[model samples]
Target: MKNARTFTTFALIALASTATALPFDAIDATQAYQNEVAILEATGAMPSTEPVAIFPAMPEEEVAAPVIASLQDVSLPAQPRVGAPAAVGVATQGREVAAPSADIALPAVDLAALAETHDALAVRKGEDGEADAMMMLSDVLFSFGDDRLEPAAVALLEDLAPELEGATALQIAGHTDAIGDEASNQELGLRRANAVRDWLIANSALSADVVTATGIGEVDPVADNLRADGSDNPEGRALNRRVEFLLPDAG
Candidate 1:
């Protein structure tokens, strides 16, 4: 009976030892698995549990606005008479008064000579005699697509300045051909008229208050801009591109 009891005690102790050893082995295996997983993560062989950090978006750039040019204010002047008859000396009708004490001799006025001397295309007297006289100047006075007066034009203006010495008022009107847009042509005409006006005021005896500049643009063309077949007419266009000077009689 004593030996049997001792054998039973020994069997129980061995079973407890075996159970404790099995639990230690299982804990070692779990620790090794955790270490391997940590190595894989550090070496970039496995993905991380931490949320991926996002990059901030770049700021957008701002755009700049465009610049625009400012134009000057210009006003139109009085329109000139297109066609008018020349003044002729009237003969005394039904006047038999031959008792005139002394024969009055008047100097004949030569308009053609006056126009040529002033370098003007034509000089026309006003119909009402009280209106302003019109003098037409060709576009040859300025370069193509330019507002500046040529050297020859300056010389011509110098000759013409004498006529404006006693003028009460002067109007400079610029006209352009129909080769460009109306707005551009209008601006060009205004620039041309301003150029002429500036020259006259600076070089001539005319005052700024008495001188006025205007742009007629292509609206007051003296000739056709296009032919019957819709082709361009260089000659007519040249004629249309002109500057007119209107001078009122001296007070």
Candidate 2:
């Protein structure tokens, strides 16, 4: 029994040595794993201990205040209001502007009203009591630069023949504008006056002795021959070229 116990003790010591050698090999493997971890950390291949955020924080935006304007800083001209009277020499942008005249004088006689009274005939009182009734004849009744009367004139005179029933005497005066020489104008006026007188004696109840024809020429003009700018006034000249009939009061 002693010999058997000695063999068992020798076997236990050998097994203990084998187990201690295995622990040493395991320690070497642990040191190799630690070295690999140190190399990866130095090369920046290993992840950090703290967790990283996926999104970054944003900065706040600053807001500016709005600016306001005042009406007193603006400059403008003062204008006339609605339905206000117009002022003369109004100041505008350091300049003077003249306003139109409002109080314009109108003509004393309304020719339109007279035309409507009788077949375009304008009748008025004779000046200085030369005659009781004075009738004006438009120059349009005669041709231009001629003493011959137009058909329209004949028709007008036919209508007027009946109105001169109780007249004792009839006087026809012809006037011309300042278009020709004084001698030519005088002759033309006399011829025009004679034409009217002859027509009245032939077509009406008036005798030749009772009718007298005269030529006043351009000396007695009823309108201005020239305008304010020295230009020929066609309208005024047309008004002056006319014939007038003077009749005494029917007694």
Query: Which candidate has the highest lDDT of all?
Result: 2
- C-alpha lDDT (0 to 100) for residue 227 of candidate 1: 98
- Candidate 2: segments with Cα more than 4 A from true spot: 1-116, 124-133, 248-251
The residue ranges of model 1 lying beyond 4 angstroms of the native Cα positions read 1-113, 118-120, 124-138, 248-251
Q: lDDT for each of the candidates?
A: 0.66, 0.67
In the predicted model 2, the residue pairs found to clash are none
Query: How many pairs of residues in model 2 come into backbone collision?
Result: 0
lDDT score, candidate 2: 0.67
What TM-score would each prediction reach against the true structure?
A: 0.50, 0.49
Encode model 1's per-residue lDDT on 154-228: one tens digit a residue: 887787776665556778888899988998888888899899889989997778998899888889777799999
The alpha-carbon lDDT assigned to residue 24 of candidate 2 equals 52
**In candidate 2, what are the lDDT values of residues 1-251, reduced to their tens digit?**
44544554464346444643564543454454345446545655553321112111223565557856568866556686688765657779989887786655423323223344565465444475423334455465798888898898888778766565344677888889999899888888889989988999999877888788999888988789999999999988987887877653242
RMSD of 2: 30.3
Worst 10 residues of 2 by lDDT: 49-58
